[model samples]
Target chain A: MIRYVIRRLLLAIPTLLAMLTMVFVLVRLVPGDAAVSMLGDQASEQALDALRARLGLDQPIHVQYLTFLGDMLRGDFGTSMSSGRSVLSEVWQVLPYTLELTAAAMVIGVLFGLPLGTFAALYRNRWPDYTTRLLSLTGLSFPGFVSGILMLLAFAVWLRWLPVMSSASSDPLTHMRNLALPALNLGLIMTAYITRVTRSSMLNVLGEDFIRTARAKGVRPGPLVMRHALRNALIPIVTVVGLYFGTLIGNSVLTEIVFTRPGLGKLILGALQSRDYTLLQGLMVIFAAFVILVNLLTDLIYAAVDPRVSYAK
Target chain B: MTPVLDIKGLTTEFRVKNGWHAAVRGIDLSVNANETLAVVGESGSGKSVTALSTLRLLPQTGARISRGEVGFGGRDLTKLSEREMSRIRGNDIAMIFQEPMTSLNPTMTVGDQIAEGLLIHRGMSRTEAAKEARRLLDEVRVPDPARRVNDYPHQFSGGMRQRAMIAIALACRPKLLLADEPTTALDVTVQAQVLSLLDDLKRDRGMAIVFITHNLGVVAQIADRVAVMYAGEIVETATCDTLFADPVHPYTEALLKAMPRVDRKAESLEPIPGSVPSISARPAGCVYAPRCNYVQPSCAAHPSLVPVGGNHEARCPVRADKGEAA
Candidate 1:
């Protein structure tokens, strides 16, 4: 298992490098000059030239790419053009919020979706099954931002149950309250995905002969479903959850924007708008790293859930 | 001696696109202590359904026991509540299914699978159950039982998995074991080994067994008595020796004729001419009438079972009349 993890981590190097190259090129391709954006429209040509040279933006694209790669290798993401702060420090500041949102969404999704899906499968063709299917279908059809807005309106504006936006408070309880609507909005969307995958996977597992064998062995309904059916059913559900978790990390952009929360999505959006090349590139690499990390965690979870599945194997 | 299991007029139905269709017609069968009663038939002849019905393990949503009384240990199993039935299942009455490759839970260790029944019914502590599980594995003759107990199902071979399944079924020392074609998934050598293992276990424990199978050869090897099912009903039933020597029903005769014998070098093995009728599309008259060579105009009505002497019975009017005339 150690060897397997080490191999995976080693393999991620090339993948991250590729991701970093693509982000570097793509951010540069955006129709604006970073130096011009930094100095604003009133800046003289000579001033723009000086700023460009100072930021090393005047160098050839290949040379700049090499410098970026070298710095990244040396564990340095250059300072943000707008804030004059290290890109890493800026990412670190907002990293927790994004992690918190994704984690909350994931927890909510699994807690509700897993059982709902299991219930749907167990009582297939019944009212509960139909209700879950319909609910998930509705959830799937709505975009995350739209749902976030709807939740904001319903809970914060209308019901006054939750705060309208995330507050700049350090208190965990108050912070949680502020994040509730956005987290729930994203969570509901994730729940839909989890429910659909869980139901189908559960249906497949429940139909398996092992489940019948378990039943024949006089395994009661609760343990039989959970230990026998659900355990086997979890592989596909885990795959879906893991893939969605990676998506949740990057896809929180719209939800964060709608909720006006200070997170990676908002951070990256700011970088993109201000043509903060260093920060944008750094955040993209971080996102890539996160996706790779999530995939690794998912694989580990698979091994945990099923004894037959092994990273070494 | 009183039977361990007495199933009377058991009818099972599956809801189809149109309506409920009976998969197992009202059939009476019983298994006495320490005896192996083999319910033999071709596929779709309700043999598996009969076994499933006995345990009330039929698919809950689409299939159901429409009418029946499964009397086991002086209690009506059909009349038992879900909770009561659960208590009986895997405790007093255990079942092992066909498809050894898939019967055991893939994610679980074979030991835990075997120990599950012990834990639930025997109320054994986890450590005790684990030890018993190892012992059960050893009894089933799985090599390195102590180490293999921690191994998942995928690690075990098909035959070993089947043995583990048997260990699970026998873990609680159930009085009756329902084996639904348990050896069908295995090759001939493994099949023989499993059959003998089951026979030995039955002998040692004196437990009744209702072995459901499609293979006549398996029935001949392990069965004390035989019940031949066709089209959702038992067409003939007799002591194993008697049934093999003189199969009275035409379906039974056809089935016996279809067997490939090594002693005779025949051009080709004979197969029964027609397939078993579909449950939903069953004929009004005798189920085998459409396929029987001796089908007659008088064979238009379904015939009830008739005594053919010495604990043998057949559900065929023409055969019964011919026997009487002779």
Candidate 2:
């Protein structure tokens, strides 16, 4: 298993590098002048040139990519072209907020989705099963941002329970309060996807003759879910969850906008708007690398859940 | 001897896309103390369903016992509440299943899997269960039980795993043991060994056993009484000797013939002409009329079971008096 993990980690490096390279090159190709966006129309040509030289935008694409690649290798992400702040510092500052929301959303999704899906599988075709299906369908249909906006309108605007729109600061313990609604909103779609995958996989596992053995052994519902059903169902749900995490990192921009929180998503948007080449490339690379690393962790987890998956090569 | 387990009119149904699919039609049989009653049938012939129904282990929405009385030790198990049923399962009435490879949990150790019932049903502490589990493994003839018990299910071979299953089932000294094709999946040598083990356990403990199988050889070797099931109902039932020697129903005859015997080498094996009838395509009256050898016009109207002799019965319009076909 240690060998398998090491091999997987090794393989992931090239993949992360390739992904970041693609995002960097693609973002650069989009028609925009970072210096012009930073200086705006009011700044003199000489001032823009000076700013370009300072940000290393004066160099050719190949030279700039080489420099960026070198700095990345050295763990330096350079400063934001718009704000003149260290890209790494900005990323560190915003990551907790994003992590807080995503983590809570994931927890909420699993807490409700796993059991509901298991129930749907256990009592398939019954009222509970039908209700779960209906709820999942509704969840899948509504976008997270739409749900977040509706929640903000309902809770903050009308009920005055939550603050209307503030870039809420991240707190470890109480961050849940600020993130709960946004998390649920982001989680609605994930919950649906996970629940659907789980229900199918749970049904398949439950139908196996082995489940009969567990039942005959008199293992109760909760233990049965934890031990037999969920573990087996995870083989498929793991793939969906892994892919969802990547999409979650990417699509979080809209959710952050809706919730009025300072996170990776808002930073990414700012970088894109101002054509902050250094910061944008750095952010993209960081996001891509982080996502790849998380996926690698998820793969290891999936292997642990299923023994047949070797990860040998 | 008092019956350790009694089942009457055990009919089971599953809700389907169109309507309810009757998985197990009306059937009845019982197992006396220390006796092994083998309910023999092909796959999907309701043998497994009957066993699951007795334990009330079928998935709730998919299946229901439309009519039945599973009387165990004077209590109607079919009528028992969920709590009472849960108490009965794996405690008073234990079951060892087929597919020994998958039957045991992959993630857990063999000892923990066996000890699970002890802790859950018997209320034994983990330490106590672990200690007793090693002893039980030793009893099942597992080698190095002390160390082997700590090993996971995957570490054991096919035979060893089945032995572990038996240990789990017999842990609480259940009065009635339900074994669903315990040896059907095993090889010949393993099958013989498992049968012998089951026989020995039954004899020693005087525990009644409901052995489900399609293999007549295993039944002949182990069962005290035999219930020959066709399309979800018991078509014929008799003492092991009588059922084998003077098999009455055509389906029973076909099953006996279907089995490959070592005593005789025949020119060509007679494969049953058609496939087992589907649950969806069940005929109006007779379930096995399309497949029977001595099938008659009256056979179209399904024959209810009637006594042919003392403690021997069959379900056929044309009784065995009109003997074998041709």
Candidate 3:
């Protein structure tokens, strides 16, 4: 297992390099000039030239790319053009919020979605099954941002039950309270995918001969569903959940924007608007690393859940 | 002796795309203590369904026991609530299925699968159940029971897995073991080994067995009584000696002739002409009429089971009277 993990990490290096190159080139290709965007329209030509030279923006694109790579190898992501703060520090500040949101969403999704899916599969063609299907369909159809806004309106704007926007609070309880609406919004959307995957996987496992054998052994309904059917069903469900975790990390941008919660999504948006190229490139690399990490975790989870799966093979 | 299991007028149905189709028509059968009753038939003849219905383990969504009384240990299984039925399922009555490869839970260790029933029905503590699981594996003749108990189903070969499955079924020492084509997936050698194992276990434990299978060869080896099912009903039943000596029903006769023999240098094997009728499309009257060579015009009405001699019954009027096919 250790050797396998080492091999996986080694394999991730080339992927990370590729992502770095792509993000470096892609962010530069966007229409606005970083120097011009930062300095604003009122700056003189000479002033703009000085600012560009100072920021090393006047260098050739290839030279700049080489410098970026070298500096990254030395663990240096240059200072943000607008804030004059290290891009790493800025990312470090908001990293917890994104992690919190993603983790909360995952917990909520699995907590509700798994039982709903199992219920649907057990009562297939019955009213409960139909209700879950309809609920998931609605969740799938609505975008996360829209739902986030609607939730904000109902809970914060109209009902005065929760805070409208997330605050950078020190207290854990306050942070959770602030996180409720956005987390739930993202969670509900995740629940839809989770429910669908779990339902289909469960349906397949429920028909398996082992399930029948378990039932024939007079295993009660609780242990039969959880120990026999659900565990077997988890392989496919885990795949979906892992893939969606990566997606949630990247796609929580819209939900973050709607809820005005400080996260990588907000950080990236600020970088884009002010043309903080260094900060954007750094965040992109972090995001790519997160996705890779999530994939690794997913593979490990598969081995844990299924005894038939062996990393040595 | 009072039979361990007695079924009277058992009828099971599956709700298909068209409508409700009776898979197991009204049938009566019984299994006594310390005996093996083999219910033999071709596929779709409801042999497996009959076994499933007896345990009330039919699929919950589409299949159901429409009519029946499964009397076991002085209680009607069909009328029992789910909670009550559950108590009898693994404790008093256990089952093993056809596919040994898929019959055990893939995610669980074979030991845990066996120990689960002991834990549930026997009320054994985790450590006690674990010890019993290892003992059961040893009883089933699995090598290195202590080590192999921790191994998952995939690690075991087909024969070993079937042995482990038998260990699980016999974990609670149930009085009745419902083995539904348990050896069908095994090769000839392994099949013989498993059959003999079951036979030995039955004799040792005095457990009644309802062996559901499609092979008459298997029946000849392990069965004390034989029930030949066709369509969705038992067409003939008798003591194994009597049925093999003189099969009264044409379907039973045809089945025996269809068996490949090693004793005689026959020109070729006589394969049964047609397939078993579909559940949804069964003909009125006798279900085996189309396949029977002696299918007379008078065979239009379904024949109720009749006694031909001591402990022998057949569902064909013509054969019951003449004692032979014309």
| Strongest candidate by lDDT | 3
Candidate 2 lDDT tens digits, B1-326: 76888889989998777688788988888898899999998877899999989999988766889997888988899888887887788898999888898888776788988898899888999999999999999988899999999887778999999999999898888999999998877888988988898899999999899999988888999999999888888888999998998888888888878788878676444667787687777888778888877778887786798888778888886865643331
Better of 1 and 3 by DockQ: 3
The alpha-carbon deviation from the true structure for residue A219 of candidate 2, after best TM-score superposition, in angstroms, is 3.4
Q: Which pairs, if any, clash in model 3?
A: none
Candidate 1 lDDT over residue span A1-313, tens digit each? 9988999899989998998889888988999887888989999999999999998989998999999899987879889888999999999998888888888888989998999999999889989999999999999899888888888889889999999878557897998898888889888988898999999999999999988888887788999887888888999898888888776875577888889999998998899789888898888888888899989989889989988778784
Docking class of 1: high
Residue B166 displacement (Å), model 2: 1.8
DockQ, structure candidate 3: 0.83
Flag clash pairs in model 1. Answer: none
Best-to-worst DockQ order = 3, 1, 2
Candidate 3 local lDDT, residue A176? 82
Q: Cα deviation of A261 in candidate 3 (Å)?
A: 1.8
The sequence of per-residue lDDT tens digits that candidate 3 reaches over residues A44-152 is 8998999989988899989989998888768798888888999989989889888888889988899989999999998888899999999999998998878888899
Runs with alpha carbons beyond 4 Å of true place in candidate 1: B321-326
Per-prediction CA RMSD (Å)? 1.7, 3.3, 1.8
Tens-digit per-residue lDDT, A220-284, candidate 2:
87787888777878888888888788888765778888877788888888887788877887888
- Residues forming the 10-long window of minimal summed lDDT in candidate 3 chain B: B317-326
Look at candidate 2 and give me any clashing residue pairs: none
* Clash number for each model: 0, 0, 0
Which candidate tops DockQ? 3
